[model samples]
Target: MESFKSILSAKGPSLFLLPTWMEQNEYLTAGFTSRNGGVSEEPWASLNVGLHVGDQDADVVRNRQLIAEAIDWPFEAWTCGEQVHGSDVFAVTEVERGMGRLSRASAIADTDALITNVPGVLLASFYADCVPLYFYDPEHQAVALAHAGWKGTVQQIAIRTIEAMEKQYGSKPEQIRCAIGPSIDDCCYEVDGFVIDKLQPLVQELANLVNSVPESMLTLVENGKAMVNLKQINRHIMLKAGILPIHIELSEWCTGCSSDQFFSHRKEGGKTGRMASWIGIRER
Candidate 1:
């Protein structure tokens, strides 16, 4: 079964929820938002939750609030980071619980991944086509959200997040459950030589770790370009980081292919809305 199950209604935020995770842990909530049922205008028409995407601040906040309401999370707990496509992982603390909820300036700076053992601090990251990597260390009641574009993927953001969880929360990698959310799949994500070159070393390392072939992560096309599988590469990276394969959930929804259901920066030619991936444990 597809791990990210869609929950749609007539007039609310459309969501793809991780039912198994939420069901297994009563206090936990994890899912990705869709581009429908919001208040933005064209290009970013409807549900665009990104505050920095040139959308009206009020509209964007309202959209975010709609998601928070739908998920039954307080909007004040919606914490986020200013994604720079880097490998830096920040452990969100209680004092920083609501940073970036209303504005970008208040958001955690220079980070692509946010991890927290702090219950009630919802870790959110925006994405259009970039992969959204999720980590849950049930042993520590901690969760994380990572934004992985090609740059962050090459830099091994997933590994960085695992390390952060281990160091900050005493989370064992073997106990961390991971999920790759909706994003541009290999069929829709074509890359040039520059990206391929950056990925070559890691691709080789992934093969060695999983005893898999290069094509499992990168398929070379013609004219110095190739189709790259960010999700699979990140999965291999998670395996290399000591996460069990059975504990990981991978989404099949491709943003680039399903523009109606998602906002694809690549398919939409860069003027697009952003969906959010969130994981939080309700304060008890």
Candidate 2:
């Protein structure tokens, strides 16, 4: 079954929700947003929650507010980072809550991942063709969000997040639930030798964990470029990091293929809006 289920309404912002997770824990709110039903114009056309993508800050904030309202989360609880496509992980405290919701300057600087055990603090990250990784530790009631592009993936941002959770919240990997949200898939993500070379070491190590060969994670094609399955690579990384396979949920929605529903930097030639992946435990 698809992990991220679409929630659409004629007059409301479109969202893709993790029904299973929400059903398992009523206080938890986790999902991704689609690029429909916002106030941005032209390339941003609709629901663009990224404040750094040159979209009108007012429009982006409104879009984010719409998502918060739709999910019944306080807009003030929305916390985010100034994603730099690096492996840096920031552990958000209550003080950091709502930092980047209104503007980029207030966002956590130079971080690609944000983890927090603080209830009511919504952890959100923007994405356009890059992977959105979600982590939840029900035992500790902690939730996290990571933005993974090729750079972050090769840097092993997933492991960094899990380790951070372990250190900050005592979250055991076996008890951690992880979900890979919509992004550019191998079908749409082609990389050159520079990227493939960076992935080579990790792919070699991942081979021992997966049943299939490393090629399943990174397939080399003609002209010296390779199709990188970032989602699978992340899953394997999670597995290697001790997260159970059953605890991992992967989405099939490809941003490149679903331009009508997502923002794809590659498919849209870098001039595009962004969708958000958010996870938080509502305050009681």
Candidate 3:
């Protein structure tokens, strides 16, 4: 069964929620947003949650506010990073809450992951076809969100986030729950020699560690290109980092294929709105 459940509302942002997480803990709110029900103009037609995507700042802010309202989270609790597509994971504190909610300058600088044990501080990251990685350490009451494009994936952002959680909050990977959200799948994500070359070593390393075949992670095509399954690669990284196979939730929604529900950077020719992946523990 697909772990990310779609919830369509008459008004407010459409969402793909992690039902098990929500059911197990009422204070927990974690999900990815769809490209519907917000206030933005073309390219960023509606529900664009990114500040630096050439969309009007006011419109982006409004769309984010709509998401906050939809999730019943205070717009003040919505925090974000500058998302440089690196493996840096920033530890968010109360002071950092709402820092990047409205503007890019206020966001955590040069980071692709945000982890926080602080209750009421929502951590969000923008994506358009790139992978959205979520982590929750219930024992420590911590949650994290990582934005992994090809660059971040190659840099092992998923493992980096797990390491950050362990270092910052004493979160054991065995105890942490992970979710790989919607993104472009191998079927729609084709890479040339440059990307395939960079990925090959990492895929080999992961395969060796997990005792799996490297071919399962990447498939070669004509002209020295390959179709890479980033979600599976991230999952393998998580498993190699000590997270149990059963503890990870993988979403089947493909942004490249579901253009009507998601904004795909590749499918849309680099001009599109961004969706948000958010996770936070509410204050009681």
Candidate 4:
């Protein structure tokens, strides 16, 4: 895995990514988005791209347009899916274009991950509290994006995404670079005894549980909710699959903490809009 930096650009209040990435000859590049810029106003603020948050339909469309321009796209060509916090990941292709729109389709039907190698095809996963994970294999010119909340993380969606990459592109876990985008960090995440009770026994029994932190200080013998570090758990999953420790990039920004910059379902609740994490390659 090579080191790559995602450059940030501000267009109005919306934030966009620059054109820089490490990839294969067939063309595989990607970037995560920051919650700045766009057309929505007030509660949704300036650039809300999520339609499920009760923002105006036209505002969301205009916001996507501006964000697309920020990335220098003539028009945003994106493929989205219903994120169910399950392990299903759709392969983006020219055949299906109507799978994940909140107007026609909500981001909450099924499938929490997306993998694609199609150029000019952007795979965007929506989330406010759920972790958005990304995968890039320079060896296979393939990429994948995942939306993992506690349920998804517990199910090891990251590992499954890698498994999909290997099956689809022959990508080795060691050769893949995983990026854990901004989400609700431990500082802003809290769980109860029930959560710890369910997780402690499982993690403690793992052959690769390098470190264990619960949602609380409950002893493994006693049920206590420990503040599970989601980012660490995702990295652990990658390492468990043989991905290099150094190959993982954890975005230090916490959406709950940076709610000023990003949306947070935990902080904003049902009324808040979602932020999107996307990645794409140029096929031409």
Candidate 5:
């Protein structure tokens, strides 16, 4: 019953696809990329889709293009954001459909989330240990991607993306299907007081709203630190925003634990490449 299923291709990039979403709508292509099947070299090793992570820009773009080809999406439709780990969500339009695919300068700036109802426009966001949040509104045919590191999670970027979808595409939260993609899990994500401070209030608020306990989302460890479950916290935010529990899919692939298949910033000491989470409605 795993929501994200791995699909290995001999000719192109390997992917972890959200099968239910693709099954529900054949025109939809939604999945996370594995750090395999690309043209980049060491640290980046293979499939690094991030343009700003010190990898050669051409290599990154080639990797991204390989992904686009693997998914049957036009490389020109591959769009992205300049993630700043904030709660800002940018509503992508037709005019901005292909920005940031080739370089960081053309990408949507200072945004952690990108939503679009436009067909043929791929919304992609890069991640190392950060969480990748996916939102799809079947009724509106809109898809969104959010990059939620601890900072963005604390800022409630999940809620911001849902609200933006509601405002821009009339997407009712209850009708919105969400997915939490591969990232570092609580088992491998230990943080200091600085992060815990930001998370505590949000965890408390979520507990009060859901009638649960804050400890369910965070575990205290030695030296004023905690092992945080960012994916669960974001799921709670989705619930608090009115997305039904049945409508959300959570992935169990932990980047830190599965570093051979993913690029883990924590496991690799901040010098790793990035994987991409992408969602788009293919042109009919």
Candidate 6:
């Protein structure tokens, strides 16, 4: 079996590889499993964590169990959201823990962001082409996991999430470690007119900074006017929000192009299964 010991030791929040230390019971470790690891059939084959994707519930449960076991934890401690694609962020508190999907309804609703200070409380959010933003504040022992698609991205979900962490847990951006997980990269992520127009205004200056045409036109630019690196844009949002660029780690892997490794909705035309990302501080 391929191991992630070296990958984890290398340091950076955007690890495709899981760390033994992080899995060792009391560390603020975070990792996302690729579509590469488990046991299922075609379409949902190998390590598919998404439940509603037509993969049998038994297979989904078994797959999730393998994923959780690989991460060195029981599936029960893991908390996941229904993922409505909005910018709502939730605080995983004592009352909310154990009351959510591992058993019943989530403590919150219509949310895409999850924050928790309760160790052993693993919070998960789903994504395919959408970006997964994982936030860990060691100072406050709090962590947040968010799923940001184009809509959520334009809405400034990253900034809003950082703001929420500060408002509720007294977390400062400087002390936070943020990782932007695997998603459709700039090169392969092409969009349409409506999206560009809606995003252009909100990301005017920000887009200008990342979406440069400087004497060159990009085919992917909607209406042949603007092109963008959504990952960089989200990174910029975090930077402006006070997250250090050095502290922010991004996976160079693009879901759209890396079809064998990840499940991309665009690459597969909406027939793809989703991937889950999470972070937690152990109670022990």
- By lDDT, the best candidate is 1
Q: Per-residue CA lDDT of candidate 4, range 94-185, in tens?
A: 65433444353643257788887666776777878788888888767778899888778778888889998888779999998888877787
Model 3, residue 201: C-alpha shift (Å): 0.5
Candidate 2 has which clashing residue pairs, if any? none
Ten-residue region with minimum lDDT total, candidate 1? 49-58
lDDT of 3 by residue, 238-276 (tens): 998999998999999999999989999999999999999
Best of the two (2, 4) by lDDT? 2
List per-prediction Cα lDDT, in the order shown: 0.93, 0.93, 0.93, 0.68, 0.93, 0.71
Tens digits of per-residue lDDT for model 6, 75-183 = 7777776677788888778666643444224435678898877778878777788998988777887889888998888888998899999999999999887888788
User: Against the true structure, what is each candidate's TM-score?
Assistant: 0.99, 0.98, 0.98, 0.84, 0.98, 0.84
For model 4, the local distance difference test gives 0.68
Candidate 6: clashing residue pairs, number: 7
Candidate 4 lDDT trough over 10 residues, lowest sum: 214-223
Clashes per model (N, Cα, C within 3 A): 0, 0, 0, 15, 0, 7
Per-residue lDDT, model 5, residue 97, is: 89
**Which segments of model 2 are wrong by more than 4 Å?**
none
Off by over 4 Å in 3: none
Off by over 4 Å in 1: none
Q: List, residue by residue over 1-284, the lDDT tens digit for candidate 5.
A: 67899998777888999999999999999999999888899989899988877999999999999999888888999999998989999999999989999999999999999999999899999999899999999999999999999999988999999999999999999999999999999999898998898899999999999998888799898989999999999999999999999999999989999987999988898887999999999888
